[model samples]
Target: MAPAAITLAAEAPKLSAANTGFMLICSALVMLMTPGLAFFYGGMVRVKSTLNMLMMSFISLGIVTILWVLYGFSLAFGTDKGSLIGWDGDFVGLSGIGLTQLWDGYTIPVYVFAVFQLMFAIITPALISGALADRVKFTAWALFITLWATIVYFPVAHWVWGTGGWAFDLGVIDFAGGTAVHINAGAAALGVILVIGKRAGFKKDPMRPHSLPWTMLGAGLLWFGWFGFNAGSWLGNNDGVGALMFVNTQVATAAAMLAWLVYEKLRHGAFTSLGAASGAVAGLVAITPSGGAISPLGAIAVGAIAGVLCAMAVGLKYKFGYDDSLDVVGVHLVGGIAGSLLIGFFATGGGQSDAAGLFYGGGLSQFWKQCAGVGGVLAYSLVVSAILAFLIDKTMGMRVSEDDEVAGIDQVEHAETAYDFSGAGGGTAARAPQPAPSATTAPNTKKVDA
Candidate 1:
């Protein structure tokens, strides 16, 4: 090749509109998962706190977007600092990069890459809201996620995905975010819940989902959006890896849902809607880190293992005396751990990298790498998150007043309610008066619908 031609090639990768368009769609899909999460969690809480639950997740979209644009991206993807963090002055406020400049050698524009990652940051902390439901003060919860994101999430994202990051350097395989997104949020959830304590009634109240249909719908959205979440991490489908990730995602999720239902049926004697929903999420979480690295058959194993493990782990709070309002710890934490570790056992050399898992004759090298990645993210997120929560709890007060909590957080915090129990007229206004029935007392009881 001519020197000028080589110089031009070395200057930048050829931009591809196809890849950029695909990424834009994926970013939108991932963005949709936040509201999907809101609905899923909203339906799980009592009617009294339904809107509050939804708000907890919805608020992240606003909080994290501002943060990401300001400095979160710089800290996460900038030039590496000791493999622990990143810092690029130009990346701060995203002012230095050109709109058309590509991300690392990827075909998509830098703006597209930043926005895609912003979606991940937004949803990661939102995942913590489920474990703190019904008891936390909304403002306190907001502040905590803010501080937690600044202190914990940014550094961790750098470590997991940034160039020269320790995990990236160590050859730890995280195709999507088994550790960065799921385990990070799960551990943080456990930390905060420990400080805030349980819901007001705890074991006495029969707190059940207000609407399983909403939960199912939310789960469906998450599943749909997750195609983008898992596949887009590869950034494109050019070499077919992203397509492989997409297929694996579906296969594993289906397998995990079945595994969870089987566990539920054998253990509880009935297949519940809740079981199906939870199972599906467990599969998604498990496959997220490994999907790009494993075959579809391996994905089934990862999903089934995560489903049963998370199902069994869900009851630990009752036995161990902690209250995780919606099993975030069980599903995200356990499933994340299972999926991360399984990458050591299931990864094939042909998928994402030449490093095979134990089953593929790759030995324990990758397994130990997986262990390190999982442990590092879990420990850091847990400790820093707990400190942030405790500080918030001590200074500003974290939980709502017991009276307000029992009365419903939605009304106390947001001045609204999810449902109205008043007689048919839906507004907050008082009911109109009714006239008395006269001597025609044999009256209106014609087989009416109650």
Candidate 2:
């Protein structure tokens, strides 16, 4: 690692404590988003399994933080041996990263910066498990995350952001984490959902959300924290590009909200808060890959298109029998692909975006590159996630028993409940009621549809 005082003469202005401080705070702000995700996902599930949903994300914070300190940073950003993975020779257990430590040219205490980036690494995979909720065992999940982070996330993150990775060599312009975060997670989410199979009563039960208000609150927090997520990609203050990313974030979100509502009104017969919230997230995902490179108008188009595509994609669960419990496949995977592909034609250079879409005649080179990046991440993630899930299932056992599942994971797995408003009634009040027998027919009558 470089010393804090070491300066590159021609590498723009060096990062200062003021800039570093802002970034450190932003990094911390981004870290809080995982818990925000917990609340968002938890609120969308049945009340019985709410705590289990929240636990999935919280566990990542505990597990990934430790892993990052161990070797996650070293493997991700260290010197490149080949275009495969980073050579793990420095900053093990936070040894070389001093308070005044420097690396990657910008100055921040390397420890602080590492912790900031670590939060991103931890949450990305956790975000995908939303598709497999209420099924997997807690121990099985822990083992899966530990393995998946090393196998899937760390390698891809290195390829995109680390010096020795393939995408870095190929000039793939993922300003933040379009491929690493969204596409990788989205593909993995799809894999796990398929492996887990549909939830027991998916189509038959009315498994509606316990609280929309909580879901809305979680989405709001994610939006606020995302400023740090998107803007902090620059890693320093006073970068002209950081300001541009910030503006694009809002523009894309606004367009996405409008587009989602318009689509919902046309198809569902009513606009829903869920649709708006989902649309905002779609915009966020779409803009993630192109935020720094594209213009405000480009962001608007990306967000609008992502909103519509993701909205349409969400309905696929009904058409196909996948049951990606909360539409992770629809929103993150689909939206990530849409944004990545669109940016190829829309990305501009020379402070003027002469780069028009295929309809406007930019041809197919950029589009093909974007597709290549997307396809590579998707293929790798599916294979790795399947292996990891299989290993964990065989070792620790992937799911709880059917009886425990019927009783709810919150009570069985965690010994807790999201709501305690039943005084002492507890399980009786919380449990679903049984239907009484009808007196119109004899109790002994054979109940036959035939």
| Predicted structure with the largest lDDT when compared to the true one | 1
List the candidates' TM-scores in order: 0.93, 0.90
**Cα lDDT listed for each candidate:** 0.92, 0.82
RMSD of 1: 4.8
Worst 10 residues of 1 by lDDT: 441-450
Pairs with backbone N, CA or C atoms under 3 Å apart (clashes), candidate 1:
none
Candidate 2 local lDDT, 1-450, one digit each (tens): 375435544564444888788888889888988988888888788888899899999999999888888888888887775887885656777776556667556766676678778978978978887888888888888888898898888888888889869877776667777889988998998888777677877787667778888888888888888888888888776647888888998999889988999999999899998888889988988888888868888888899999999999998998989888888889989988988888776776522224444644567666777788888888999888977787777776788887787788889889989888767555765576867767874475333210
Candidate 1 lDDT by residue in tens digits, 1-450: 999999987877767899999999999999999999998898888888899999999999999999999999999999999999999998899999997898988889999999999999999999999999898988998898788889999999999999989999998888889999999999999998888888887987678898999999999999999999999999987899999999999999999999999999999999999999999999999999999899999999999999999999999999998899999999999999999999999999999899999999999999999999999999999888888999998999999999999888999999998877765554445455657778786475532211
Q: What C-alpha lDDT does candidate 2 achieve relative to the native structure?
A: 0.82
